[model samples]
Target: MAIVVVGGSTRNIGKTSVVAGIIRALPEMRWTAFKITQFGHGVCSANGEPCDCETAEHTIAVSEERDALSGTDSARYLEAGAVKSFWVRTRQGQLAEAMPRIRKELAATENAIVESNSILRFLRPDVYLSVLDPATADFKDSAKLFLDRADGVLLPEGELGRPTWKGVSLRLLEGTPVFAMMPPIYVGPEVVAFVRGRLAAVAADV
Candidate 1:
């Protein structure tokens, strides 16, 4: 099964939109989508809110999306045509505790698409696309660590203006394919074609 991962440098840069766009663009993939979230300290992973709970159960929680209209990121995956959608939450630095269940879900899917940079730590996807906004100044360490592994990058439409981020070098993006991201659907035709070609190559090798 082919796997695609969509990751971003920071929040609110349309990573979910990109995943949903790809799912909607290629419905035949019958993608099972995952939205992985790591809650920070003193936050409850179960409900993604501030809490003092330190129980094991509160450290990790995974749930399948059943309501497409729920407006959650995982629910958006279902609304975008994913056959199955899951929301996985884990406390900071504890994603390893949730991998077994995540793996079982992966084993049952024809293809999978996940939204998280941290998952790259355990699995190598057929296609890994990182969404970048040069104008945005915040760059997460996970994104920086995995930037070089990205198969392609999605950038805002137009020339890449000077990046406002500190301690980030454009050299990291060198030799990587860049696709223009037009809003409403961050996955453009070129990005879709690229993902299809990658998956096709994987199927051929199999």
Candidate 2:
């Protein structure tokens, strides 16, 4: 199965839009998409809010999204034509507890796409794309940790000029391909073509 993982430097930077765009652009992939939400530090996984409960109880939770009109990220995936979609919720550092299920799901799927930077710790996807916006200053450490592993990058429209993110240099993405994207239409024809070509090449090699 081909895995396309899409992550971003920060939240609300069009990561979901990009994932949905890809799924829409390539309807034949019949992608089983996943949107992972990790609640870090003092957050409740079951309720996604602050609670007095211990972290163990909220180790991991996975649920299939059935309603395309639910107005959730996973629902967006379904709305975009994904054959199946799931939302994985886990404690900040407890993702390992969900891997057995994740692995089994991947094994049974034809093609999969995930939206999380931390997943790189468990599996190496066929294509890993990092979506970034220099306009956003809050960069997640997980995103930075796996930035170099990105097969390609999706950036905002217009010249990026020099990025101001601390400890992140242009050198890190010196040779990786960058595709300009705009909101609401995060994945354009050119980017779609690039992804299709890359996946096709991967299939040919197999």
By summed lDDT, the worst window of 10 consecutive residues in model 2 runs over 45-54
Best model number under TM-score: 1
Q: TM-scores for all candidates?
A: 0.92, 0.91
Residue 124, candidate 2: Cα error in Å is: 1.2
Evaluate residue 59 in candidate 2 and report its C-alpha lDDT on the 0 to 100 scale: 73
Summed over model 1, clashes come to 0
Model 1: per-residue lDDT, tens digit, 108-173? 999999999999999999999999999889888889999999999998893578988888778888
Best by lDDT: 1
Candidate 1 segments whose C-alpha is farther than 4 A from its true place = 42-56
What lDDT is reached at residue 66 by model 1?
Answer: 96
Report residue 43 deviation for candidate 2 (angstroms). 4.6
